[model samples]
Target chain A: MSITPEERLNVAMTINGRRYRAGVEARKTLADFIREDAQLPGTKLGCEHGVCGSCTVLLDDLPARSCLTLAVQAEGRQIRTVESLADGQELNTLQRAFREQHGLQCGFCTAGFLMTATALLEENPAPTREDIVETVSGSLCRCTGYETIVAAIEQAAADGAEGNDDAKDGAQ
Target chain B: MKPPKFSYVAPTTLDDALKHLASDPDAKVLSGGQSLMPLLAMRLAAPSILVDLQHVPNLSDIEDRGDHIRIGARVTHREIERSALLADRLPILSAAASHIAHPQIRSRGTFGGSTAHADPSGEWPTILLALSATMQAVGPHGNRTIEADDFFVGPFTSTLRDDEILTHVSIPTTRTAWSFQEAAVKKGDYGLALIAATGTPRGGVLVDPRVTVGAAVGSVTRLVAVERILTDEPLTDELAEEAAVAAAESVKPISDIHGSSDYRRKLVASLVRRAVVELKNGA
Candidate 1:
C-alpha cells in the first residue's frame, strides 16, 4: 500500500493593507500563517478551538477566530489585525480608551477585545452600554471582570460620536 | 491542538464535491467550519480529505417560497437570525436562532452544518424538528430527502452517508402560533432540555399541537402524551400544569456534568408549562 501525499495549497491574502503569498500545508491555520508566514504576531491564539476568542481577527471586516480558519481559506480575503488599528504612531480611539480606562490587565486578551470592539463600533458608532457588553462578550478577559473593558468601548463609541469615527476605514 | 494533516479540495460545484466524496470515502464536508474545525483541532474527527464547499453556488441562498422556505446549505446562523423573512414567517425559529452559540460562532456556523452535525442538544435540530423540516442531500448516486425525525440518529450522528452531502433544508410554511423554551447553563451553551410547541389557534384554543423536547438522552423526542392532553383540554393553568407533568414523566433524560436526569425532567416540566402559557397568551 502506498500513502498519498498531502497537497500544499497556495494562499494569497491581504493583511493590514499588505499582501502576502505563501504555500501552506492544508492543515495550516490562519493564525499560524499570520504569525509566521506574514510575520505579524499581533494575532494571538489562546485556544486552537473556537471556544476562546483571543485569536479573533477581522476576516473580510467580520470577526473570525483565525485559529479555527485554515490559511487556504483566506485566499483572496481581506484580514485586519491589531496592527492595522494604529496610524503610523497614533493609537486609535479604542486603544486610547483602553489605556485611559485601564481596560486591560495582563494585555494578553487586549487585541481580541480591541478587534471585536472595532468591528462593533464601526458598524454601530452610538451603541448603548448593553450593546457594548454584548459586542465584547465573545472575547474573554479573566482580569478586570470586563467592567473596565466595557466602559472603554462605551467611551470610545461616545468619543467617536463627535465625528472622529475613523475606525471604519481601518476595518476595511 | 491543531488539525491533523489532510488534503484539501475546494469544489465549486455540487457534482464535483460529490465526486470527490465518492472517490474518497474518508473525505469530510466542510461548510463554514465553525463546528467541524473545532472537532478537527480537538482530534475528535480526523478525516483524510476535507471537501471545502465555500465556492459551491446556491448553497448560501435563503429563498422565500410561497409556502415554504428553501434554505441553502451554506446559510450562516447569523444570517438566519437577522433574516426578516424568517422573523416574519418563522418567528419561532428566528427567536430560537438567538440561542445558538454567541455571535462569533453564529457568524461562521452554517444552518446546514449545524443540522448535519446533529448534536442531540443542538438548537437547530430541535427547532427544525419542531417545524417538521426536511433534509435535502445529494450523493454520487442521486439526491434524497429525509424528514427531520429520520435524520438525527444519536449524539453527533446523522443519517447522512459518507458519500453524501447535505445540500439544503426545506422548512414548510409555519403560519402557526409557536413557543420555544429551554434551560442552558450559559447564554450559548447547549440546553439541558429544550421544548417547543407548534400549533394553530382554532376556536379559541391552540390546536394541532406538536411539542418536541431536545437534549433528553440522545435525540429530540416529541411529547405525544402531553400534546394529547393539551389538544383534548381547553387552555388553562390547570391543563398546562397537567401537560407539564406528563411531559416531565414521558422523557428519559440522562445525567451529564451539566445536569442530572431528574434535574432535566424538572426542566422539561417547567419549560413545557412556560411555553404552553406563552403560546396560550398569544393565541
Candidate 2:
C-alpha cells in the first residue's frame, strides 16, 4: 500500500501513443518521469512549483501540470506531450499556425501553450478570443508578447485545427 | 525543485486510507495535488507519507438530490465548471470555477481538495460559505458533517482532523440571485480581493443577503455588517454604496506582496458594490 522514498515502484503509462514503464521513486514528479525516464524533454519545467505552465501535458485528454503530478499518480493514464503535436517531421495545424503567427520567440513555454490549446480546441472546436485568452492565461509566456500567441490559437481555430481527428483519438 | 523524501500510499478504500492516516501522525492526504504539490516542491511541508485519494471509489460523483446537490470530494474544478446540473442549479460555482487558476490547474484540482486546503485566497471556501454548504468528512471512527462557516479556521487551515478525509460537500439548491467578483493581476492569478454574494430578491427588497469576502484576510469572512445593511432593504445604488463602505471598514486584511491592505480594502469595497449592483440588476 505504501512505497517508501528509498524504494522504486514500477509505474507504467502511455505517452504519445507508446507505453513507457519505469521504476520511479514515490517523490519523482511526472515532469521528471517524462523528461528523464521516458526521454521526452518537450515538456519543459520552468517553475517547478506549478506557477509556470511550461510543464503542462495532456493527462487523460485534459491539460494538467506535469510538474505538480507525481509519476505514480499518472499510472495507467494516457499522456500527450508537445512531441505528439507533429506528424513525423511535419508540423500539425496548431504548430503551423503558431509558426505563421510568431507565437513563440524563446519557445520555452510553447509546449505548455500547445498542449493547453490542443485540449481547448478539441473540447470546443471553435473557441472565441476570450475563451482562448481565458484558457491560456494560466500559462505564462515572456516572449512574443501574448497577442501573437492568442492570434496563433485564433488562426489555428480558423485553419480548422479541429479537423485533425487523429488527435481526438488519444495520441497518434 | 524536487519534492522531499516521502512514502506514497494510494488506497482504493476509504477505510484503508483512514487506517493509514490514523497510523501515521505525519501523513498528509493527497487530494488533487494542485496545492499540496506546490507546498511539497517548495519544501514548506515535509510529510512522511502521502495518502493519495485518487484510487478511492465513490469520491468523484456529483449527485443531484433534487433539493440539494451532493458533490464528492474528488470532483475536479473542470467537472464543476462543465457540469450541466451545476450550471443550472449553482451557476455561481461554475462562474467562480473559471476564476480558479487556469485550465490546467482546474482540470486536476478537486473541489473538496480546494475546500480542505482552505486557502484564504481560495474561491471554493468563499463560495461555500456564501452558499451555507455542509462538508462531509470520514475518519477512522465515523462520518461527520461540518458547516462551511466552522470548517475553515485560518489560512490553509481547516477543522478536518489528520485522520479524517473530506468525503463530499452538500449544497442546498436555491433561487437566490448570486454574483462573484474578484480582482487579480492576471486572469488566472490568485485574487487580491474576492467577493461572493447571494440574495433573494422578493418584490423590491433583497432578502437573506450573504456577502462573503475572501483573499483579503486570514480567512473567508462573511461581512455581517454589510449583510445586515442589505437584508430586507430595497436594492438601490445608495444601499449598495453603504454596504460597500461597511465591507471596507469591517475587515483588517493582511498586507501581502500581491496587494497592500489599503488597496485590498478598496478592492473589497469596489467588489462589494459591483456584486450588490449586479444582484440588484438581477445578474
Candidate 3:
C-alpha cells in the first residue's frame, strides 16, 4: 500500500552558528537536508548503508553519520560540517596538515575524516598513535593506507598546542 | 536514495505512539533512524506511517537505580560510552557500545533500537544475552517485561507484538564479573564473530553467552551445551577453551561474503576462548 504525501514538516536547526529552517519531506535524511536544503554539499554520501563513514558530521560537538539521521531529528540541534572549519581564506590546522601530509586522494572521504578528526582532537588534545587509530577507526580511506592522515592529525595537534601560526597556513 | 513518501507523526506520549502503531500494522517507529533509514532507502521496508519518537520525554534518560539501572531505549550509544555508572555496573554494555559502528553511529544509535532490531550480529543482543538483561516494552495495552533469551526470535526480528514500543532496558547491578571480545574484518562493520561472557554473584556464573557470527552466519544460535558446561563450572582458561570449542559444536554457521562458515566457526571458538580466558584472569 502506498502512502499519500503528507505536507512537509518545518525543521529549524543551527549549523555552524547559522540557523536554517526548511519544509522537508518526512523521509529526508540529515545528509540530504544539509546538502540539498541548506546548500552545504561538502558532506559526501557513501554506501548510504551507514557502513561507510563518508557521511560523517558533527551533531552537538560529537561526530555522527548524517546519512542515517533524520532531518526532523536534528531540529533545534547544533550541526557542524567541514565547511564550518575554515575562517574566510584561512584554513583550519587539520585541513593544512591534511594538505602538507597528503592525507587525501580523490577527496571523497576527506570531509568525513576531517569531521571525525576534529571531534577526536577536541576530546583528546595529545592523543597517542593508538588513540589516533581508534579515533579514526570508523572512517575508511581506500587510498594512502591512512598513514599520512594519522601524521596530519598528529602534526595538527602539535601545531595547535604550540600555537604555531605558520602551521595555520598548512605549509608545514 | 530518497525514501518512499509516508505520513509522519511525532507522538509525544507513549499512548499516542501505540495508537499510531496500532492504527497501521506497517507503521515503523523511528528511533535515531540508524537502522530504519537504510531499510527505507533500499526499498526493503516500506511503511505507510512513520512514528518519530525523538520528542518523547523520559525515553532518553538513563536512571542509575540502586540495584539495577533503567536505561531508556533512546539512550544513545554515545551516552552509554560516557556513562560512569554504566562503566561501573554494566561495563559490558558500555564496552559493546564503544565497538558499535564507530563514534558517528554511536552518537545517534539507541540501546533500545539495537535490542529491538534484534540483529544477530549487532553488539546489543550479544551483550544483553550475556547479561540476561530485561527489556520492558510499552504498548497500547500496557507494559510487559521480556527476558533477553525470549526477546530475539530471528535475524532483524523481535518477539515484540505489533503496536508495542520498547521503552527501557533494565540490567542487574549485583553481578560485576564481565568479559567481552569481538573480531571484525574492517572498521565499523558488523563483527565477524563476537562473544560476551558475564560472571554472576554467589560464584554461580550466568554463562548465558551469545555467539553471533555476522555476515558469515545467516542466523545466530545459543550454545546450550556450552552453557551447561559453564553453568556449574568455574571460569578458567582451560575450561573456557573447552567451552569455546563445545560452543562451536552446537553452532551451524553458514559461509557468506564476509567469511566461510568453517572459518567463522573457528573464529567463534578462538574468540570465545579469548573472552573466557580474560574472565578467568579477572579482566
lDDT of each: 0.84, 0.91, 0.79
Candidate 1 residue lDDT tens string, A1-172: 0122265667899888778899789889999999999999988888889877889888887788888888888889888888888767888788899999899999889998888888787778888898787677778888889999998888888778321234335434
* Candidate 2 structure, TM-score to reference: 0.97
lDDT of 3 by residue, A1-172 (tens): 1123567888989877688999988778899999999999999998877776898988877788888887878888888888877777878788899999999989999999998998888788888988888878888889979999999999989877322232222321
Give the number of colliding residue pairs in candidate 2. Answer: 0
* Most accurate candidate by TM-score: 2
Residue by residue across B1-283, what tens digits does model 2's lDDT show? 8999999999989999998899889999998899999999999999999999999999999999988899999999999999998999889999999899988999999999999999999999999999889999998879999998899888888999989999999998774689999899988889999999997678877778788999999899899999999888888899889999999999888897788999999999999999989988983
TM-score of each: 0.95, 0.97, 0.92
Residue by residue across B1-283, what tens digits does model 3's lDDT show? 7677888888888878888889987888889888888888888889888888887888998888998889999999989989998888788777777788888888888988888888888888877776677999998878899987788778877889878999999987765767777888865677888777676634544444333333335544456666677665677778887988786887777778778888888988887788777766763
Q: TM-score for the first chain of model 2?
A: 0.96
| DockQ-superior candidate, 2 or 3 | 2
By lDDT: ranked, best first: 2, 1, 3
Cα lDDT tens digits, model 2, A1-172, are 5798799999999998789999999999999999999999899999999998999999988899999999999999899898888888999999999999999999999999999999899889899999998888889899777999999999999988973456547543
Off by over 4 Å in 2: A167-172
Each candidate's fnat, in order? 0.49, 0.96, 0.74
Question: What is the Cα-based lDDT of residue A167 in candidate 2?
Answer: 56
Worst 10 contiguous positions by lDDT, candidate 1 chain A? A161-170
Assess the local accuracy of residue A81 in candidate 1 as a C-alpha lDDT between 0 and 100. Answer: 87
Candidate no. 3 TM-score: 0.92
